[model samples]
Each structure stands twice: as C-alpha cells, then as structure tokens.
Target: MTTLEKKGSDGGGSSSQEAAARRGPAGPGRFMGGQGTEKSKDFKGSGKRMLGLLKRERPLLIGVLSLGTFSVAASVAGPKLLGDATNLIVEGSLGKAFAGYSSKAEAVAAQHGKGKGKVADLLSSVDFVPGHGMDYSAIGTVLLWVLVVYLVALVFGVFQGRLAALAINRAVFRLRQDVEAKLSRLPLSYFDKQPRGEVLSRVTNDIDNIGQSMQQTLGQVVNSLLTIVGVLAMMFWISPLLALIALASVPVSVVVAAKMGKRAQPQFIAQWKTTGKLNAHIEEMYTGHALVKVFGRQKEAAEIFRQENEALYASSFKAQFISGIIQPAMMLVGNINYVLVAVVGGLRVASGALSIGDVQAFIQYSRQFSQPLSQVASMANLVQSGVASAERVFELLDAPEQTADPVTPERPDELHGRVAFEDVSFRYDPEKPLIDGLSLKVEPGHTVAIVGPTGAGKTTMVNLLMRFYEVSGGRITLDGVDISAMTREELRSGIGMVLQDTWLFGGTIADNIAYGADGATREQVIEAARAAHVDRFVRTLPDGYDTVLDDEGTGVSAGEKQLITIARAFLAQPSILVLDEATSSVDTRTEVLIQRAMARLRSGRTSFVIAHRLSTIRDADVILVMENGSIVEQGNHDELIAAQGAYHRLYQAQFAQAVAEVD
Candidate 1:
C-alpha cells in the first residue's frame, strides 16, 4: 500500500495530516504553489546558472567565438573597402572636371591661384589624373575585395553556427540526462505533493524552452554585441563627431530594453506557470475521462480549461506584447541616430573637413552600429522566456534529494522472508504522531493480513516496510538484517507487489506479463500466466500471447488487467509477496479464482495481504486490525471475532446483511 491509499486521494493528494508526507493537494507553498502568481525570485542568479551549465562545452564555445570573431572582422572590412572605391570615383570625376588642363595640379592651381580654396583642400587628398573619368578598374578591384571579404565572413558564419549548435545541444542533452537521473534520486514524497503533469511540464516543456532560448539567443546576442563594438571602432575612426551622435541613441535603447524586459519577465514566468497548471488539469481530466463522462462534468471541465487557457493567453500576450515593443522602440532610436549622423556628415562634406566618401562610410558605420542593437532588442523576448524556463528547471534540480543509499549495504545471505518492525514510530507531521512505538513480526512462509479503515496506517505500515518513507524511530528488519542498511534495490528485489491499480504499458501481453523479471523466457511467462489464471483469458484472444495492449490496457477487462499484474508478480517469483487489495477490481468468481491462485503462490513464501473486504482474508494465519496508525486488535479471524473487538465489529457490520439474506 502506497501513501495515496492512506490518504484515499483520487487526485494527486488529499487533506490529511499524515498525507502531508506525500504532499497533499493543499500542501505547503512550495509544491502546491502559492496563489499561482509566482515569478522567478532570482533572474540574474538563474541566468548565471543557465550559462554555467555550458561549462563542459567551454572548448566548443571558444571555437564558436573564434569563428564568429573572424566572421565579424571580415564583414567589418567591407564598408571601408567600399568607401575607398567611392573615393576613387570622386577623385577621377574631379580629374574629368578639369579635362583641358595639362596636369590635375595645374587645373587645381588655375582654379585657386597660389592660395588654397575648400575644393582645392579636398582635392589635395584625391589622386586626380588629367582627362580621367570614373576609375572603373579600381572600382572593380574594390568590388572584388568586397565580394571576397563577404564570402569569407559567410564561410566563418556557417562554421560558427554549426559549432554553437553542437555546444547548445550537448549542454541541453546533458541537462536532460541530469534531470532523468534526478528523478530517480527524488523520494516518493516529493512526487506526492506535486502534480504529475506539473512535473512532466518541467521535464519536457521547461527543459525544451531552455534549449530553444539558448539556441536562439546565445550566439545571436554575442554576435550582435560584438558587431556594435566593431562598428563603433570604425565609426570613431571615420569621424568622432558623427560617431558620438550615433552613440547618443545607446542610452535610450538600453532604457527601453531594461524597462520593458523588467515588465515582461513576470509575464513570461506567469505564462509558464499557467502552462504547467493547465497541463496538470488536462492530464487529470484525460486520465479520468470516463469518470468525467459518468459524472456529466464535461461542461464544467471545459469551462475550467477555458479559464486556464484564457489566463495562459493573457499572460503570453502581455509577455509578447511587452517584449515586442523593444524592436520598434530600438528601431526608432536607431533611425533618429541615422538622421543625425547623415545631417552632420553632409555638413562636414560641405565644409571640405571630410571627403564625401569618408562621410558616406561614416553614414554606413552609423547604420551598422544601430542594426545589431535592434537585433538584440528583437531577441530579448527569447532570452527572457528562456531564462524563465531555466529558473523552473533549476528549481527541480535544487529540490532536496532523498537520503543517500548506504555506502556499505547489507544483504541477507538467504531469502527466508522473516520481517519485523521493532519499536517503529512514524509521523507525516512532526507534531502529529502516527504509529508510535508499533511493533509486529511475521514469520517465514506465513501470511499476515492487515485490515483497517481508511487512514488507519495499514498502508503506511506497508510503505514503511517497503522503505518508501523512512521510519521516524526504531528499525525494520528482514531476515535479521536491518532493511535500511540494505540498498533499496537489494531490499525491493526480494519482494513482489501487486498494487490495486493495474498498470499495463503499451506492449504485447507476453511482454507485460514478463515485465518484472529481467530476461524472462517465453516458457516462464506462459507458466506464470497459467499460475495467475491469466492464460485462460489470454488464450481466447485472436493473437493469443502476441496481443498488444495500449498504455491503459483498454481492450482488457478490469479483472483481466488485475490478472495480468498478478502474472507479472508470479514471473518475478520474489521470496516476499505483497498483495494490496489485488482482488478488489475483479468480479466474485474472478476474485475467488485470484484468491486460490494467490494461496498457491503464497506457499513457502512470506506474504502480506492488505484487504478492505473482510471475507477474503478469513483464513490468514494472523489478522491485525489497525486504527489511527496502531493495532487495536490482533489474532486469527476466528480468535478476533471471539474477542468482539474492532475487527469483529467491522466484520459484523460488513457481513450482517449478507448473513441475514442467506439465513
């Protein structure tokens, strides 16, 4: 019996003091979530952690950066080269302007005599030849260089992209692997408090978001920032005054990004939170779809889904809308800077303080500087959304892990299933005592039956026995060795459990039956099925043992599913068997068949039978009636009835009507 049985929760959890251990629906603020308006408490901290995840890929990252640098360097040189070509054309045209002169210097000297004019000063820098037109050959040379430089940048860019992709994917792959390992390390109690869908969202949706965020932003942000720096250097080299004017927009762009990012971050967090919540609701409703239909809750479920969807849509829209403003806002600032630089450059050209070609290059540099800024702003949303997901993933990674397995674990030499609980005490809540100082022993090859009402700690005892939850005090031993000292694998390997809820994965009938025992042979599977009375029903199918079942085993009846699980247990052939109301789902005839099969399977093996129905376990060697986490009556059924205590009263109440009808 698991913790859910003790709480009687059909959903993830229920309201019970002891149920808190597993995590009730109304649990502490951590798992159940607080008011659903929560955001990442630490943004920069999570961002650092997200970046830190790429530590192992530092080499690949360095290679990517190296290629990107080369790429940017090549791209930056193109505008300057084009400017040089422009200078050639302007100088050649000036040579054509004074075509009748004997030399270009004579023409310039004729125009300005012995003193210098503004045009003459500008012409001093130009290499003008008499009768020369536009320098088509030189322009062609510069164009070829431009083409060569751009091609080089393109090659480097492709390689940079490949390397960056490899790095990001590898980091995400490792993160996925870490989360997978972490799930095994987490205690069952951790899951008890959290919805399955919420956890699933963290593993699938959140992690995927982290990968996408990094993929879309990491290299792009680096490239954009570097482009700004490279372009700034060239801008200042061309003309400091225009460069200053272009840079004036930086503060405004930064302000817009910072403010909008701050506002949008909470919305992204809310969006993901609502996503997890909605997934949980969908999963719950889908799992219990039959129940919803039976109860006619389709309209209510649809309405609830609509509300959550609306919440998700609102949060998403706000996040996107806020972040969306960044690009146009940045473009506005960039355009203003472009106009200022152009006007300033035109005046510089008019005064002959700078050549037209230099002013043209300066204008290009100004545009280059602002373009990357717009790109960075545009990708801000991906970065923010990714960081939000990173924060969530980090939460799962930071969740307190289960107690470590013993370094030097003990294992029983032989499998004699003598189990004992010695002065064992437990509590889901420290203040609320449960099963205090309770002690019980079961001999080898004997069956111990635990009968109790809901929340009576019958299931809790089994949970403790299975070491699902550690005992608050004392110890539990199997075959004279403390069970806690043994590794969980070793402890559980000796025991076989058939839970009330039959789980049959998507596989053939033979595979589901052979699931528990590794390397189970076909004969072994068939033999186990025969022993569990599953062979009779299975043989009637068209495909026989090869018949495939869906995840929920839809084609099979409830009795058939239970029988299949029983067959799985039989295949395991464990020394200790636990049957937790295994026959409850079957019909009277099927239940009788199961009891007979279980009796045979229990021979020479220590078995613990937990039954809610009283009549089934009347023949057990020992009967313990539990209430409020302690044994209130103990004996065989006949002896307990003679005592007329709790067990006798429960039996009478359950069977009195049947007894009257039969009499």
Candidate 2:
C-alpha cells in the first residue's frame, strides 16, 4: 500500500461539502474531492479579452511585431542570396564547360550544331565567364552577404523574444493584480457558492496557463505568420508559377485546421474543468485526512481519487490527441506542395524561363512558406488550452462585485455602542426565511448574552450586526445613525470579534497578537497575551512571544490557538465585542484567567456573546433567549430562570449534560 493509503483514508473536499456551517465571512466548507468546475467556456470572447488586456502593453507589442517582421524579412533573403552564390559557381563552371565559346548560341553551336539543347537553354539564363572555372571571390562575397543578413535576422529575433516576454509578463502581472482586487470586492456570500479548490485553480492555475502559453506561443505565433508572409513574397518574386503551386496547399491547411480546431477547443475546456475537480478532491482529502483515517475511509478516498484521475487523463488525452492531428496533417499537405513546386521549378529552368539558381531559391521559399503553416497548426492545442483557461480567469474577474459602500457616508461624532435592529428581515434564500422582522436594542455598556440551540440564528444575528450581510429589509443603527450610512470599514473599526474558529497565519506569536491593532507595540502584545492567559503557555515554549507558528497554529494545541485569537481581540480594545464561544476551547485554569479578562474587557463596552455553555452567561447583565430567529425572552439570568421559559429548559438540559459527562 502507498504511504497515503497506509496512513489514512481522506476523501476530497468541494463546495458541495461547504454546506455552510458558518453563514457569512466564515462561509461554508464542504468535503467532496472536486476540481476544474467551470461553466461552458467562451473561447472567442476570452481570446478577445486577453488581447484587450495585452493592449495595455501596446508599444512593447508593436515593437516585438516590428522586430519579428524585420527578422523574418531578412531571413527570407538568405536562400536567394545563397542561390546567387550557387549561380556564380555554376556560371564559372559552365564557362569552362563551354570554353572557346562566348555565349549560349556558341555553346549550342558547339554541342548540337543545329538546335538549342535544353542544357543550352538552361545555360542561356546565366552569363558565363569563359575559361574562368569558378568565381571564388564573387561566391565568397555572396556568402558574406548571406551571413550578414542571417546574423541580423538572428539579432532581431533575439530582441523580439525578449520584448515579447517583457510585454507578456507585464500583462500577466496586471492580470494577477486585477484578480486580487476582484477577490476583495466580491461579497462574502459569493464564496459560499464556489468550491475553494476551483476558485484557487482559476486564480493560480488558469492564470498560470495563460502566462505560460503567452510566453511560449505568443512570439512564435506572430513570427510564424510573418515568416509565411515573407517567404510567400520571396517565392512569388523568384517564380510566380512555383509560388502558385505552393499556394495550392493553403486552402487544404486552412480547412483542416478550422475543422480540427473546432473539435479540439471543447476538449481543452473539459480538460481544465476536470483538473479543477481533481484538485478540489485532493485539497479536501488532504485537509480532512485525519478524520478519514479515524473512520477507515482511505480505500474510499483512494477510489474517488482514482476516478477523478482517470477523468482528467481521458480529457487531457482527447484534447492533446485531437489537436495533435493538425500538425502532421499540415506536414502531409506541405510535402505534396514541395514535390509539385520542385518538379515545376525544374521544368521552368529547362524551358529557359528561369535560371537554375532562381529555381533553387524558389524551391527553398516554398519550403519556408509551408513550414510556418505547419508550425502554426502545431500550436493549436496550446492556443485552445490557454483560451479555455483564460475564460475561467475572465469569469472570476467578471463576477458581480458586492454593492459599493455608500457615497457621502455619515457616522456619529462619537460612538457609544448603542446598537439597535429596527424590524430587520434577512434570508439566504427567499423561500426559506432565516431571520424575519427581528428587532432588538442593546444599551451601551451592557453585556447581552445570546443563548440558543443550533440554527436559532444567534450567529446570523451577530453577522448582520457586523454587516457581513445586509438586512433584506429594515435598517440597523448605532448611536442614532444608520449603519448603512457608514462605510463598512469605519463601522467595523470600533468592533472586535473572536470567532469559534481561531485563525492564526504563519508568523510569530507576537505578530499574531498584534494583528488585532495597527502597529501595536511589543509591550501591548505582551499585555494582551497576559490578559488572554496566553503568556504562561507561550513562555513554556522555547521562543515564548517570539515563537513562530504555522497558519494552522500547528505547534500549539486547539485551545492555545483560541487563546491567541482571544489575545488578538483583547489588543483591539474596541467599544463593542463579539465573542463566539471564545472561552469554550481553553482549559479550566485558562478559562478562569480569560473570564477575568473578559470581565475587564466588558466594562464600559457593549458586548454580544454567543454561547452553548449555559453557565458562562449567568453573570451577564441581560440574557436574550432566541428561538427561530426571534427573541422569545429577554432579562437578567435570574429573571429568565424565574420565568421558566426556553432559557430555563436550555439551562436544565446543559446542567444535565454536564452532570452526565462528569458521571
């Protein structure tokens, strides 16, 4: 068995798995090994948009085009120049073959004495130097010219490639930046609908595909086109008859390419789509490997992975195989053209209509011309695949952004954290209302403890207050000002949130704690750490506050991770606090320290707490018991207990559960 299989069973993850445990900012994360999930690709539209994107590098693109043109033009002159040298050698040799004769007529007279022979007719096209066996000096000069022209072409080609790379890199750089900004503008709810791996594939893999193809195929595409034009022009200049013969293959190449291209395009799209599905599967399984192992689902995970891998292979094979046929098919047409051009040129030379040197040059041009056609046909898969990837990236860029912050926004001169919801209504789906016409007011400097069973919309209420989701109807206000009238940034500025899932990036503990505030000092980080009871455990580690941690906080336990997050929130020192089971993760000793900190943190501040642990809210100034998105009862803990309502039953159930766990 493979190491992965031997160790664990971990199936993949997907948007399907993200059935949304956390509604908004902490959106849904589901497990379904899936990748390359995209809609029908728009090849033409994406190609156009990609072109438009590159237009920003207009001057560089134009420069590359010009250099490629000059380069190809210079290269096309090489065979003809070499042909001149060949003619020089032939003229000198024929001069010796027809020595004691000054002209073709004299040569014909000497050889046939009556008719102009085909050899003599061919010789008639060149002016021979009688008795000069070969003009070595003239041949050398022609070779030098050939060398200079080719060298110049080489220089231009080198610069053209460099400039092409520069332009393409710059364009891709801008594209990445646009994608980054687009992600920021997208609403939190948008992520709930997308698979994490698929989104990642679009942002990273698809964009990378675009960059790679543009770098490798962009300059080559332009150069191949220019080479065809230059070579065709040279072919016609040397011998229009042979040029027409070479042109015979054009319609065939075009027709074949068009047919094969249509077949290949869709396959490329399918290939990328399957890739995304596979990546999502891998990402999910890897992340949830431990769970899979504990459940002995490794065999199941492996089977799913194999299925996705097989799908990817099938798609990739079809795409490559279909596109691969074009190049060889184009080569077949080119070879036929080569034979026709060669035969025709030879006949023209014998007919005295062309010199042997011009026929050779014309034949070379035919080959050169057909070569570009084949080159272009060979690049079909790359072009199709790149455009498919491009469409995915464009889809991301074009996703509808969140509603913009209001212009001429208003905020209170001073915030007292008096928050109120005035008949608010909200639902993730219109058919299923989650919160409807819910109304409440929390006075400044009071702790409101929200207690409820799962799906009671406790978290949803806080999310609305945080403005992660706008209310479908009615308005929420703070300090007599509608929050909608305030920028999200400004409204969130005075609030600190510590969620059930603690997020710690790959950085030092000090930095993670300081992330709560802008440019917090070392002293402030240590103070916050102490308040959250993180300092004691942090000091037990080798590096203490300076100790580094992974994004998952791998070096620490789950409880420690939550403590660090609490410490971060403590440093923020906001006027309002949202703690979502913030104290539940820690040990009993640490919980005591955190409770003391929380008591101090709650003083002179409006706070909302979501807790399943009923004991924690006993000291809250007011306990709001919510059920089905409505406040069934609200009062101090003792008052709610005396009323014998939903809050009382919840407290009893928890007390019983606690007693059972102890037993």
Candidate 3:
C-alpha cells in the first residue's frame, strides 16, 4: 500500500476514503467535489449598477457622441453635393430632352385656350433656351463640387474610426483594471460558491462582448441614428407629403426589431453561460485524463462531453438565428421606403411640380435616412448582447463577500509562540457547525498532536488557529491577543502551515523553497532544504538547486513535493507552526526524515500536528483524541495509553497491524 493510504488508515482515513470514492462512480459531471453546499442568491439590481458604471465614464460617452455627430455631418454633405450636380446636368445643361422649341408666352396662351394646363404648360416652365447646346462647364462645376464633398466625407470616415478606436480602447482598458481590482478585494466566499471556470468567463468572455459592442457597434449605432434624423428632415424639406410616406417604414422596422431583440437577448446570455459550463467540463476532462483512463471511464466521460457540447451549440444557434435576421429584414424595409420616395418624387418632377434638383436631393436624403435605420437595426443585436454580458458581470461584482480582514489591524510587539482557541465554533454553513463550542490551548515551545476519525473537526481546529475560517461563537488568540483585531496578513505572516496536499509552482528549486520568505539567501535555503531532507536529492539533480520544475513539480515524486512544502515552511520560521498531515505522502523512511525536521523546527515555536501515524507524535507534549466534533481524550501519549481509552484503543490497533506486516 502507498504511504498515503497507510497515513489515511492510521488517522481520519474514512473521510479521505469517502472523498476518493466520490471522485468516481458518484461524481457529478466534471464539477464534483469542489462545489460548495450553500446556494448563491439570484443576482439583482443589475440596471442600477450599469447606470453607475456609465456615469463614471460619462466623458468617454460624450466623446463618442461628439465624434459620431461629426462623422454623420460629413456623410450627409456628400449626397447634397451629388444632388446639385445631377440637377445641373438635368436642367438646360442637357439641352432640352423634350423636342418642343416653343417660347413660354406661346405655350401658356395655348394652355389657357385649351381650358387646363396641357403638357405645353409643363414644358414651358422648363427653361427652353433657344439654340443653346448643353453647358458642360456648369455640369463640370457640379461634378467637381460632388467630388470635393466625397473627399471630405472620406476624411470624416477616417477621423470617426480613429477617435472611436482610441477612446473605446482606453476606456475598456481602465474598466478591466477596475473590475480586476474589485475582484481582488472581494472576500473568499465570493470565489467559494462559483466555479473557477464560470468566474473567469465573466472576467474574460463577457467583458469581451462589451468591448465588441463598444468598439464595433456603438459608434455605428450613434451615427446611424443621427443620419436617420438628418435624412428625415431633408426629406420633409423637399416635400412634406413625400416625407410622410417615406417615414412610414421607420415605425414598422422599430417594432419588429424591438420584438426580435428582446427574444434574442436572453438566449445570448444563456449561450454564454452554457459555453462557460462546457469549457469547465473540457478543462476537467483534460486535467483528469490520467485518472479517467486508470478507472476505464473514458466512454462515460466522452458522453458527458458530448451532452455539454450539444447544449452549448443549441443555445448559440438559437441566439444567432434570431439576431441575424434583424439586419436583412431592416434593409428590406429601408429599400421599400426608398422605392416609394423615388416614385413619388419622379411623378412630381414629370408634372413640373418640383425641380430636378429637388427630386435628386430628396432621393439622396431618403437613402441617407434609410441607411442609418438599417445600421441601427444591425447594431441593436450587438447592444443587446453587450447588455446581457454586462448584466452577468455586474452580478459577479455585486456578490456578497466573505468577511474582510481588518483595516488598521493591531501588530504584535514581540513573538511569544503561544496559541489558544476559546469556546470556538465554526460552520461553513450556518446550519451545520463543524466545531461547536470547543476550547483548546497550546503554550510556547510545545508540540501538540491532534488525532481523530473522519468529520471529527481535527483539521477544523488547525484551521481556526490559522484563521482560515473565523470562529462562529468564540475567540482565538495568538500570544494572548485576539486574532480578529489583527490584520489577516500580519496574523498569517507569523504562522507557518505545511499541508499534506503539496503544491510546487513552476520555478527553480531554490525559488520554490524561498517562496515563503521572499528574499532568503542561498545558504538559508540550503539549510531549510537540508532540514527537510530535500538537499540530498537536490544535489543529485542535473542542475543542483537551479533545476526548473513543471507545474506542481510533476518531475518530482509526491514525497519529494511534500518535502519541498516542508522546506518552505521551515524557511518562514513563524512563531506558530501547523503540520497538517504533512508527512503523510512520504514513505516510512522519508517520514522519519521529516519527523526529525519537525522536532528541530518545533523547539522554540508553538506547533500543532495533525498526525495519522501515532508513532510520529510519541514525544508530543499533548495528544488530543477527537470524535465527531468534541474532544474525547487529551494527555501525553504514555498517559493516554495508560488510561486505555479512545487514544489507547486506536494506538493498539495500529500497533497490531505493524506487527502483522513484519510477519
């Protein structure tokens, strides 16, 4: 059996056993053991938060508006110039398309004699300059004006793009920094209830949506709205009756777009949520690939992945389909509006009721108006998605945080190496207390061992002393000072914890050892490593202390990783030490090495050892046997064995097992 199993068999083995069991047959789809028991409340008041965020960035919004207006103005000027050019060409410059050569006096008298204005009356109003060919110079002047207008329009286009790009980029950069800072300040409980994957999606994907909306769609929407307004006004100026018919398409398009956008927004949000979930499943599958193969559950894992993937695809399709239709439908409506205006204006020009210039200008204005409308319809989809993502981000930002570490916290004048828990009680959830009204104390320069069955709160006791969880109904003090009054960083800086679950980051061996004390010298690191028995192994490596390790030190054995954690703790040299099943992963021989190091480190500090192997703590000043959430016995090893109580019974069982192994 592995040393980890042996350690488990000796102390709190059943709890670990149950946890391992849950990793297999009973585990939930990719999100098993890490879920918190408590459910998070549904997020609320998102609009208020959004409004607040916008208010803080009012300057940016104003800048977008100003630039967008300028772009629209330049755009509008282009059509007017083209319309004037067309008018110049269509007038006398084209040299009388109609073949009638009668003067205005003769045509009007002839029309009066015929009782109503005949076609001659219409032709008479159109200046029939006798014997004059087309004025190409006038046409050239109009064309030149149109060309200059287009040139300025191009400049405005470039200006608008640059301004929008710069402002949005700067604004979004600042926004992300602010959001990240807010995340850092939030209490641990905020992370506790969320899957790491989902939280990261909000920080990354959701914000990316907002950026897309701003940088890609936001300016377009604004310019489009302004264009629509300007176009409508110009249409009205040309002919109010024609303008009224032209704008009939606007209300219909707006209603249709509003209905579609409302339906599409929720699906977009749901799509993002499912994508996050699917990514979580994929991450888990890759991370636990070895375990999946070892257990021969590959087929089951594949089915689980397929289901999540399908769900994400379905949501994405639904969202995109609805949003995608808005643009084409809007263009269809705009086209109809344009066709109606052209037909009406052409009739007015044919009847000599409007000038060719007026008809041409109205057509240009109508297109300008309808084009912005179409743009708005397209941008509506993006804006809705952005709002949806914004809502999710706001939800995360508004979550209730765990307790904050104290500000202006007390700092100790000197180190005493004493720790105490008085009437301490704690519950991860309020309804289920793990440690209930329990009290314990350890003096300076003493080694204490905690042993218990599964769910006996032995680890909880150590956690309380370390202040990972605050006590629900009591006080924990270090050196006779209440820990709640001290800053968490200050309190933690004075305590060293060596957990069984070893985590070694990717770095040089020396760097990993000195992680606990940022600026330790080479000699100090070597000494700590020697004390932890990793120095002997380090010297044998190709790079000695400079050997780089993979994440969590995959290059090293589990036992070696545990030793590195111990070396890190030793280097910290805190007033209080916690060895939480620290030597559990190492073999018996390596445990002996770690035990010797523990003895040396415990000489002048208050130390708490959660021991599974009873032999390692034979010299402990105090041994506490815990059952359920209460202490069943406490005394020196010899005294507990003499009493033949809970501790005595457990020790004999392990001893008998050891003897049987020898045989």
Ranking by lDDT: 1, 2, 3
Better of 2 and 3 by TM-score: 2
Q: For candidate 3, write residues 1-663 as lDDT tens digits.
A: 001111112223343344445333433355333222221122234434433555555666677677667666766776666766666555564345433535545645656677755454455545545335567787788777767766775776677677677766766677688779889667544454455667778889888887787777756866777787777777777789888988798899989898887777767777777767666566667867999999998988887767667666776787789988888998888888889988988878767787677787888787777777778878766776676777778777667654676767776678787778888877655665567778888889899999977678787677666555567898988888898888777787777887777777788999888988878999999999999999989999999999999764867898888898889888888788888788988999988878887888899888888887899899999999998678889999999999989998889989999999999
Count the clashes in each prediction.
1, 19, 0
Clashing pairs in 1: 23-193
- Candidate 2 lowest-lDDT run of ten: 1-10
TM-score against truth, every candidate: 0.94, 0.94, 0.88
Which candidate leads in lDDT?
1
Give the TM-score comparing model 2 with the true structure, all chains together: 0.94
The per-prediction CA RMSD against the true structure, in angstroms, equals: 3.5, 5.6, 5.1
Candidate 1: C-alpha RMSD after superposition? 3.5
For residues 404-502, write the lDDT of model 1, one tens digit per residue: 889999989997999999999987667778778889999999999999887788777887888878899999999999989999888888888887877
